[model samples]
Target chain A: MNRLVLQAQILELTAIRYTPAGLPALDLVLKHESQVDEAGAHRKVALEIKAVAIGDVVRRVQALGLAGCSVFTGFLSAQKQGRGTVFHITGLES
Target chain B: MNRLVLQAQILELTAIRYTPAGLPALDLVLKHESQVDEAGAHRKVALEIKAVAIGDVVRRVQALGLAGCSVFTGFLSAQKQGRGTVFHITGLES
Candidate 1:
């Protein structure tokens, strides 16, 4: 079995490009459906985050918040175009 | 217990600002150390990819690769500044 890890639930999301002032703009949207942890019961959370890296993108993501998640890295043996890393998320509607 | 997913391995990295050619510049670097699968024997891969999102970033990440992995979304109740979503990953050199 592949070595897996623990990730939480994803919720509603929105993204915005970072501005000169510094705050990132929320310009993206996503459909969510995942599992999460509440006070006690194992309630499913709403949104999830997932990404890939080969250079510093991954590390940058982690530095942002390396908490509970199962990140992955892979390559397209086909095109070989997407070298470095390719990540995704689980949970969410799927 | 929080709901989690199956992430893969992360690898070495190198990023550069995208060019006119239209390749998102890979301008970053990261460490590797994780697990993977090959035919049968359970082998730990040597890389992991992780990231966070809010707005269009998360959707962008997933649109890239919506595979087997545990992604999460959360908020820093403290700041409320990092609202929208915050994701991270495991399987890396935590």
Candidate 2:
């Protein structure tokens, strides 16, 4: 039961690369901003997250080209060789 | 559409504190471990995320303590004075 549904804009994107298994992978940074209700008060929330898209979703994300906001469905995992987390994208909705 | 539902165990918990606004707040670290299907391959995923419970949910999380795994529903926000993100817990399911 690890799932994340986020609506954000692609703030930065890198060239598509291939994994060791030859799967296409795209890395990007996403910027999210919204107002949320917390402790009975409305709060403005904003953050940027690092995300990656692999396999079939890579092509779709490439086509989008950081044009507008999109809803992304994914799971979070630790960076393979780093100190932070990465959102592994599995689905996308423009 | 910013939501995250994760099942994880509480790795570390801080004593309940009060916010400047007088709302109760509890901070904790969550460790998540699972197997996920990605790019047509099964991958083992594990991550430790910092999370916080405020308002009414703080009491519930305090009662649960670090006993076992639980599902948490929340939103991600940037750390107020840091570079990373924090999970703001809103709901819990044991």
Candidate 3:
């Protein structure tokens, strides 16, 4: 089980494109900032993550127009050799 | 809100260390592999992530001896500029 739930603003967006399978896809860069409890202490945390939405989720994200924050639930996967990881968003809660 | 729950194997472990504040800390590289549902299809996912555990959590991770898989619950935070993101694990389930 691999899941990531995050509330982040759309920092940047790439044009909607199609996968080799012809599925609509949208790529995004997300900025997340919040205070988190860790090791019995609260720490300020910030992250910039690479994420993508495919199929139906792509259109919803495009409609949102990168204007606001949304909570995204997704799975993480490695992109390719030496490319780091990417978040694959499956659900969105605005 | 930002949270990530992932089941991964401990791929590599760093020597137990202490923070400047004297809190025990441990660094790890985690490898995650699984089949995930996304966009109405099952896709194979694999990731190698950098993670850290501090304070009490550090001891527990060290005792586990870098063997087997565990489910880790954490938050993502960016490292220094251009260094990518790190996972701050707060809870572990063996």
lDDT values of the candidates?
0.29, 0.90, 0.86
Evaluate residue B67 in candidate 3 and report its C-alpha lDDT on the 0 to 100 scale: 61
Which of 1 and 3 is ahead in TM-score? 3
lDDT of 2 by residue, B1-25 (tens): 7899999999999998999999999
Assess each model's interface with DockQ, reporting 2 decimals per model.
Answer: 0.08, 0.82, 0.82
User: Relative to the true interface, what fraction of contacts does candidate 1 keep?
Assistant: 0.14
Q: What's the ranking of the predictions by lDDT, best on top? A: 2, 3, 1
TM-score on alpha carbons, each prediction: 0.22, 0.96, 0.95
Name the regions of candidate 1 deviating beyond 4 angstroms.
Answer: A5-32, A35-80, A83-94, B1-30, B35-37, B42-44, B52-94
- Candidate 3 per-residue lDDT, tens place, B1-94, comes to 8999999889999998988878889989999999998888888988898999998888777777786578998889997657478888888876
- Per-residue lDDT of model 3, residues A1-94, tens digit only: 8999999888889998999989999999988999998878888998888889998898778877775588988989997657477889888986
Q: What order do you get sorting by DockQ, best first?
A: 2, 3, 1
Give the best candidate by lDDT. Answer: 2
TM-score of chain A for the candidates in order shown: 0.22, 0.93, 0.93
Q: After superposition, how far is residue B38 of candidate 3 from its true place, in Å?
A: 1.0
Q: What interface root-mean-square deviation (Å) does model 1 yield?
A: 12.4
